[model samples]
Target: MLACLLLAQLLVAFIGRSVGPLGVLIGEDLELSKSQIGMLPAALFLGQAIASIPVGFVVDQTGSKTLLLLISLCVGSSFILMTFSHQFGFVLFLVVIGGLGYGAMHPVTNRGIIHWFQRTQRGFAMGIKQTGITTGSALAGLVLLPLAAMYGWRQVVAAACLLLIMGGVVSYTFYHDSIKETNQDKKNLASFYGSMKHMVRNKPLMLVSISAMGLSGSQLCLVTYIVIYCYEYLDISLFLSGVLLVISEICGSIGRIVWGIISDRLFKGKRVIILMIISGIAGVTSMILAFLPPSTTFGVMIPITMVFGFAISGFNAIWMNVASEVVDTTFSGLSSGFSITLGSLGVITLPPLFGFIVDFFGSFTAGWIMIVGVMILVFMLLLLLLLEIKTRAAY
Candidate 1:
């Protein structure tokens, strides 16, 4: 099941990350300003945001395996449609479609993995799955950039679609999860609301929501801008930038699986406090390096940034894990749905916010500062959860 989840992760990454490379092509060919380039990313996130609530309900009604197969097709077709997108508006439309397809994975995939893996092994299980994002990013970095460089932009888009189709076929054939019996306690809508309201009223779901917001927002911010940042700020080649993203993602992928295993073994499957410390360290470390004087040495900045990526996703994988512990299993779909939906707001708001900052201030460094600032809560929340974990009754 972990192996299968890992493949889904790989496919999700492959399908989702073409935007960065696409943004580069669109900017050059379309004569876009930094602000204009944001439209595609903003569109993608917006699509994801739009579908966020709906996908959760879908997962609850059907099952994740079913949702995954459907999403793969939807997202794959969105990629195929992308090949015809010559104008900004056309691309914008496809971006939304692609984003919606991408967003479906979280609610569907997160719960499915939780259902598949036991508590003791979930960190590593989900970690291995998270590697799919990095793997896709790395593949895109290596393949998409060069395809755009040599064959032109359309080929790059076409290639992403091809990968998604293959993954979809595999998913349809192999991935299956028996529908869980809805809990006797969860039979009523009132009980469901009461359960979540309890989390909202008594626990730190809101705090976890804030953490998710920061992590998701900051990660997308980097994904949106890193290619442009490298070209504009670092004076590196596109191929080199792509390769760096791939390498960092590879490291991040390893970090996710390894950290999951570590958090479980060392902390005995209590995840919150452990990921918080890691996030804080990653946040601070990445901030320090982003400020260093720009030089050829800046080529090394990606690995530095990737440490933060590893930590952010580490905590992200577990937020739902912990939430599942707090809520009843019958409603894990709804809990994950709510968490991912609200968390997506960060992605929607931050990219354009950072874009405006760069447009006005004319410094990517300040944008980096804004991105790293999200980690401040990592320290605070970690301490909070650490204390909460001691009581084991906070949820």
Candidate 2:
């Protein structure tokens, strides 16, 4: 069951990022301008953001098992349909179809892991589970580009469909819908509204949610634009930079597990403090990398990117774990859903906005500064949250 759940997340990440490595290939094959190619990704994210909360609400109503089944079917179908796309709008539409599946997975999986794991072990377990996303993304980056290089984009899309079909079958046959309640339960609004009122009235958790939005915004912008920025602005080879991005994701995969284990044991439930510290480190490092001279190379930047990935990656579980504790249990799915949706606004606005900054200002410097600034603001909010926690406990 555990292994099956993990496979579900791996496939989730794969379907989510299926088109990214092929961005350059898709452009050449379709005779697309940079903006047109860029729109496909933006469309996917916009679609995902639109779908996430609704999926969560549905999961809260029906159950994650049904949602998981829907996700697998959607992924299988989306990839197959995408292969037939020949025009820009057609491709964009196809990508949005896949985005709907990817968006649905976020809340479903968050609630699923919460149901499956114990609170005491959730930090590490959820972190390990969430790494499935980076692992799948890293694999797609390694495989899809080369597959496109040899077999053409259509064959690659077909192959993705085959994998999704297999994964979907496994998810349906083995995944048990019966979940033991963890720290959260009660999916109804009688519960949800009450939980919302409680969470909103709690100052510390409110601060944590605010900090999470800022951190999420920064990470989304960084991940979405790093590829384009490196290729377009830094003049790095696309294939090589793609490989480096995969390596950084690999580091993130390991980092999530390592940090989770640390938080589970040594941090001893100090996850919020740890998150604040890590966000600050990522902020400082982002600024340094942004301002690096042209003399700096990809090799030097890989480790820096890895550090960014690590710090940023751990926050997903850390924030969700905190959400489980701070809010009324009934609302974890809804809270996770809404916070992730709020985070997706960065997804909606940041990438193209980053492109606009680069296109107009003629530098990634301004863009990086904006991203780094968000991280710093998140760090400050986390610090204030810590103070609020201390003050409340004192009473």
Candidate 3:
């Protein structure tokens, strides 16, 4: 089941994250501005944000298997349709369709973990599962850009969508829900309202979710612009810049698994401390990028991108674990959904704003600085959350 869930996530993430690696190609083909290029991913996240909360409710009522299958078909079909798009507006519309499916992924997967894994094991399980995201992005960085360069962006997207569709079929055939729903487990509108009220009133959950807005925004910015920054500003070849993205994603995959182990074994399932550590690492890396010179060597970039990926790209697993655990197991999907909805806000807004800053300033420095400020905000919010957790324990 975990394997199937991971596969499904990987495929969906491939489609969702494809925009980052393909951004330059798409911009060149369509004659798009930086902010317009940024808007492509933002549209996808906007669709995701719109769908997350409602999908969370649906996941609780139904199960993940059906939703997982639907996500594959939805995202795959959307990307396939994008191959027909000649204009930026049409492509954005299709991307939004894909994002709607992307939104359901977390609620379904998080709920699956909550149902199947014990609390002691969930951090690691969630980490292993979340690596599907970075792995998918890595695959995109590794595969799609080269394929697009060789064949064409449209053909590559269409081919990838076909693979995603096949994976969905396999996931549906093998994966079954661990938890069985009974009459008593059924929820109504009143129950949803009650859940919403409870989540809103839950201070720790809210703080963590809000902090995720910054962390998530910063991560998206890194993914969206890092390639462009390397290629355009640092005078790296386009292929080498894509290689940098692949390296970052590979390191991110490693970070997710490593941090999960730390939370489960070393921290004994405490998530916030690890989050604080991630925030600090992310902040420091962003600071470095803000001042990174154009003449910097590829060798120098390697370690910097690796550590940056480890922190910024690696944070979601722990964050999702925290969101799911803070609420009732029954509402794990809803809590994850709510947190993602808030995080999606960051994903939607930050990339375009980061691009706009770069466009206006004619450099990537201010954009990197913006990410540094976001990390600082995340660090403070996590600190407050830690204090709240400690205070509650004291009482």
Top candidate by TM-score: 3
TM-score of 3: 0.98
What's the candidate order when arranged by decreasing TM-score? 3, 1, 2
TM-score of 1: 0.89
Off by over 4 Å in 1: 179-202, 388-395
Worst 10 residues of 2 by lDDT: 177-186
Worst-scoring 10-residue span by lDDT in model 1: 179-188
- Give lDDT tens digits, candidate 1, residues 148-206: 88888777667777778787778767877754623223234555566556656635555
Q: What is each predicted model's overall lDDT from 0 to 1? A: 0.70, 0.71, 0.91
Worst 10 residues of 3 by lDDT: 177-186
Instruction: Give a tens-digit lDDT track for model 3, residues 146-190.
Output: 899899999999999999999999998998988443222788999
Give candidate 1's whole-model lDDT. 0.70
Q: lDDT tens string, model 2, 264-334?
A: 89887667787887788778877886898866678877888788878775577687677666655555566
lDDT of model 1 at residue 239? 76
Q: Which candidate do you rate higher for TM-score, 2 or 3?
A: 3
* lDDT (Cα) of model 2: 0.71
* Per-residue lDDT of 356 in model 2: 67
